[model samples]
Target: MRFIFSVLFFALMTFSLSAQGFNNGVSGEKTFTFFDKAGRNQATFFSTTPLEDINGTANGIDGTVSFDVTNIAKTIKGHVKVEVNSMQTGIDLRDSHLKSPNWLDAETHPEIRFELTGMKDVKSEADNKISGTATGNFTLHGVTKEISVPVTFIYLKESEDTKKRAPGDLLGVNSKFNVKLSDYGVQNDIIGNKVAENIEVTFNVVGTVK
Candidate 1:
């Protein structure tokens, strides 16, 4: 009994010291900006597009993020989930129409997702950033297509005087991710088949290893 207890106690202590404790991760609320009125007047048009706050889970945005200080190139693979129903363009009538069977078909396709496919090391005049491409299957209007989004990863480390664990060798993904409505068989409206093609999407993600 004594030997068993001693061995178990040592193992637990080693795990507690070497393993990372409950990590208080960072989260962000993203905004969607659109060039309105024929790409002339650009404005943020979202009714409630903020992410539901990433949690520590396999499927969560922050969950799959792995970080490495010496070799960030080795740290690859992350996940993110976007709620389709949460899209808002600041117009109740338009939002409702979008929810219909025309644009997104929210009832059928509820999520827009991305999976990392490649990574590259990049140096800035001031900071370190990682640029890469992500391949994702976006299902819209009952149609799913394989699409690639240009992405950039920028990492910001914490200052020494800070209180909590800072994000070091932070990964920054810069991408020019875009898609079209008609390409996915979705129309602007039930009557108008003309969809403002070329939807430009961008993301700046920072992930920390727990």
Candidate 2:
């Protein structure tokens, strides 16, 4: 009877362990640094107006995220930032103009950042991903505004493929949101109808944790 009880307990433990997925049963708060393989992280912006539409990409993306694997919806926190001077609009002249004081003023405000505050309306998805609305403070051109963005996060356990990108477990974040240039003290009218007042921004970044 004693032997049978021990076998039953062992089986239960194995079952519990197998039930854990992406995070590999890791719990509590884990910090994922975006600095590793940051070049692959991408951020883009699109502006549309009646006269013309323009789009640009910024390659300078890095940040850190701290969150509990067990309670991501409630405990996720971090900040993602993009270098203002790294923006490229295909046209070299326009790119230079964008970094000038009349534009983003990259010399003074080198980075545009989003600091996560809280999350809500979370839903679990397949492949160890979660979708939710994240409320955060977005700072651009030295001005900060409160905004809510729909974000999706995916966790990948360390493996051979993941090691190719980084050294540890990976956290993937994807989000797209709209921002009004005027809200951030950006003058959208200087370019005439070429630049829209509202711009759509999208980013996909992966951070890693050991």
Candidate 3:
């Protein structure tokens, strides 16, 4: 009877330890959408022609983020996909040219993707907000490049509004970064002088726990 009691005590301790380990981290998934009324996703480009700047936006951006709240820097993984065909530069002819084979090749490579690789310089701030620099592989026009993006995020526990809509933990993210078109094998001599090679991209995302 003494030996049986000892074995049961050991098993209970092991089970308790396992439970603690599991509860230490919070795992969740979120599907982020840009077409929502509250979301915004856009890119800006500079043009020497008329010395103006151009703005293009995509309304069909969608993606998913899988996050572990307890280990944010290491266990946060996400992928964002932009529908190239859905992008518009505010001009019909210019938009067509931008999506042509010589530019983004939207028909062939219909999606621009970014996969999160790591996070750095993470700082947890007040109000459940965290700021960091995220490194990721950006794929555009069939070329892949590593890029670093500065991001700010806030985590919200389930509230009245979230319970009515999201029903779980909510995360809000904002990030901005720059990319060069020439680096992605997109070059056109005729428009090169008119349009700048570097583009600025911005992301405003809201995610909910699965």
Best by TM-score: 2
Candidate 3 lDDT, 136-191, residue by residue in tens: 99999999999899988777778898676556677677887878888999874324
Residue pairs with clashing backbones, model 2 = none
Native-to-model Cα distance after best TM-score fit, residue 188 in candidate 1, in Å: 3.4
Question: Candidate 3 lDDT (Cα, whole model)?
Answer: 0.70
Candidate 2 versus truth, CA RMSD in Å, comes to: 5.9
lDDT of 1 by residue, 12-53 (tens): 875442222111233332211211222221112211123221
Q: What is the Cα-based lDDT of residue 105 in candidate 3?
A: 91
Which pairs, if any, clash in model 3?
A: none
- What is the lDDT, from 0 to 100, of the residue 4 in candidate 3? 100
Ranking by TM-score: 2, 3, 1
> Each candidate: what lDDT?
0.44, 0.82, 0.70
Alpha-carbon runs more than 4 Å astray in model 2: 1-24, 49-51, 190-193
Score residue 5 of candidate 3 by CA lDDT: 100
Better of 1 and 2 by TM-score: 2
Expressed as tens digits, the lDDT of each residue in 1-210 for candidate 2 is 999999999998754433322334667679997764547888999987686678899989888888777677667788889999889989898888899998899999999999998887776675477778999999999999888999988888889999988888898889998988989898875354557878999988888884
Residue 115 displacement (Å), model 2: 0.9
Give stretches of model 1 more than 4 Å off: 1-63, 67-75, 120-127, 136-142, 160-173, 190-193, 204-209
